[model samples]
Target chain A: MIVDEVDKQIILATQAGLPLVAQPYQAIAAQLDLTAEEVMQRMRIMQENGIIRRVGAVPNHYKLGYRYNGMTVWDVVDEQIDYLGQLIGQLDFVSHCYHRPRHLPEWPYNLFAMVHSKTKTGVTEKVNIISQELGEFNRQQEVLYSTRILKKTGLRIGR
Target chain B: MLSDFYMQLLNDYQQDFPLTPRPYLAIAESLGVSEDDVLLAMQELTDQTLINRIGTIIKPNKMGKSMLVAMAVPEAQLQRVAGIVSSFSEVNHNYERENRFNLWFVLMSSTGELLQDTLDEIEQQCGYSTMRLPLVADYFINLGFELDLERDQELDREPDNGCDRLSTN
Candidate 1:
């Protein structure tokens, strides 16, 4: 789709990220010589067009005191993946759950779920619950605890 | 140019970031301003490149397939690898990390095979072996950005998953 110059400018500015201010839109308005309403309208359009999925704050999981966060990989049966994933996702503790290629020789887990709890034992408990709930589809599982934390940034796109 | 009012507004976002259709009105009321003013400010911040996009923090599994892919792309051909990976519609976010298994990106697709095919295509196109580290479990803490600014807390790897699990609305 053909984006006008104003839309282009808004996209470019937000590529870096939205400013953290009470009137952040005002800051952008001054930069673009447009009204804050205009900038918002354009963003709404971009979001509607799938150019941007969301504009929001990403929470930091570590700082809030709860310490046990681990990635749980499961080798679930193919046919039951959809139903099993929905069931695993229903557990509030499972923050992220999805299916990726097992990549046999390289990677062996087909379905991955993130479990967070107050302790490693808690995470393991949740994993066990998921495993039991998985029924016949559950084949194998592993938890890769993070060894280091990396910087997380929002998506940046060029128009 | 964020004013004191803007700072106050951000504070509100950090404290009680409401999850509602007209969330801005609540913020405006908290700041003693009109909802139009809050909306206008947010638009300006977005335009100026300060705050990231404001939207829902989806509790994973609600959407399509999401996987973490890593590749051992030669330094000489890093940009090419990134280009090839980014070309795929499934590749939503990509970045280079300081590790032996360097190139890291997130692939979100409706089908697992489709995600694998895209990665295989990237491997063939970029001449690098990509490692897929799809998450099996996820834990989230309520540490908003406000804490980051206040504390120069280093984002390091720690083995603790005591995070609150709430579908906050």
Candidate 2:
């Protein structure tokens, strides 16, 4: 997925959002001086390559009343991580699940799943369900709740 | 309150939004509604700030390198340190969490060298050591969140859990 200058331009132009119009691609094409077909073709290719994960509305979890967001981290059996992680990731409430290196004594958890809900109790319930799913493999777990959003400008590539 | 039509629009079109000349029209046809109706609902959603944007979600580290960095700033200096960290274009999604490592942020750059440079710069500016956690593997498929709109309505009736006050900060 080698994105050229034109592709970069397209990403820059639409990363914030597609134009709210009848012909959004045409609007993007006009801005980049490329044809609508070119924009569509490039975007389709990018989607195929997994460069563009999806093309749609990004809902604001907080605004949608999903006020409680918990980063639930777990220390699972090393050999069973991939299998356990896949199971956790498939849960509808788990938005972003990943395996990251632990920082020794301070951070013993390697598996992280971000759970969201309308209430704190709801968040805990979701965590409980995940714990049941992990079962014997789940060694230890902790949830970190974000207290404040300092910055949230998503993926900006400078021109 | 979100109408049934709005819920359908949000849930089904989180991924695989049309790439045609008239995407809204395509959506309307599939949903069995007029194009104008779909456009109006989308506009309403945007106006309410429910949806951040209708656009492409770029895969992480596909175009460049990125890492999740955390810092334990003293409470008094958290705001100042966060301001300095957020000033960098490379730093996105800075947050204050309920932990010893209070400040967490994601930093991204076009190259590996650049990413390291930005991290070093943040530590130097903030006068705090950072714990860098890079992704080892991603387990989740990148499909967008599926909104259970009806469940949200039901939950709205439940009593508060005393955590809603934290949002004021």
Candidate 3:
């Protein structure tokens, strides 16, 4: 899905956030000299093409009482990684799950799942649930809790 | 504690937010609330720093290339190294975690070449080798977090959840 110049403009305009108004699309269209219908159409097309994952209210997990977040990395059997990864990803507690490459001798975990909870105990409980689901296939695992958010500015694409 | 109305606004609108002309009105109609009420609630939520934004969550590697990179910084130089890394616009979500590879962040660029260049520059400035871990497969279908307001209410009653003191920032 190639994002043309117009699409790029739309992304830049709304990436920060859609305006808080009765007719947000119209406001964006006005900025770009595009019709409201065209703006909505382009966005819809982008959404269908997987360019736009979703358009919604992004909540701050920390402010929402999810203070404890652990990036739980697992060294699962390679053969069953996709199957197991899918299973682990579907859990309600897990937010971002991905199969990443492991730098052996230094890093040995390939599967990473970010678990968030209101309490540290809650995070451990969620990890335990994942462990049970993995069972014998779960060879080793470690949870890296973030102590400080050094920087957290969300993605910014410049023109 | 969040009101039930606000909870509904947060829970239901996390994903599949209206793409219509009057999205707020649509939400108001669906939630059986006045459009102004919905608008005010959303504004209040944004003001409270609860709602980061009402916008699109772009898929990684779609508009540009991105990868999660980690570097092990000495405790003494952690702050300095993190400052250098975060100085680059490409690097977002820099965090100091509890591990040997303490400094972790995600880097994104419009092109692969630019992404590599940023990574190289970070290593040079920070004086530490970085572990570039790009996503091979994403298993999670992001449906947004399901907030359990009831559980949160229960937790509010507890004496200490370790994070009693909120940062003013």
Specify the highest-TM-score model's number: 3
Residues A75-122 of candidate 3 have per-residue lDDT tens digits of 999999999999998898888888999999889999999888989999
Please say which candidate is ahead in TM-score: 2 or 3: 3
* TM-score, every prediction: 0.52, 0.90, 0.92
Tens digits of per-residue lDDT, candidate 2, A1-159, equal: 699999988887877889889999999999999999999999999989888888888776666678888988999988999998899988888888889988889888989898889788999999999999999999899998887777776676531
Give me the displacement of residue B62 in model 3, in angstroms: 1.4
* Weakest 10 consecutive residues of candidate 2 chain B by summed lDDT: B160-169
Error of 1 at B18 (Å): 8.4
Ranking by DockQ: 3, 2, 1
Top DockQ hit: 3
Fnat by candidate, in order:
0.10, 0.72, 0.72
Chain A alone, TM-score for each of the models? 0.72, 0.94, 0.94
Stretches off by above 4 angstroms in model 2 are B151-169
lDDT of 1 by residue, A1-49 (tens): 3456787677657545445455566677789999887877777776566
Local error of candidate 2 at B159, Å? 20
Tens digits of per-residue lDDT for model 2 on B13-72? 878899999999999999899999999999988877777788887777776888888898
- Alpha carbon deviation, residue B64, candidate 3 (Å): 1.5
Which docking class does model 3 fall in? medium
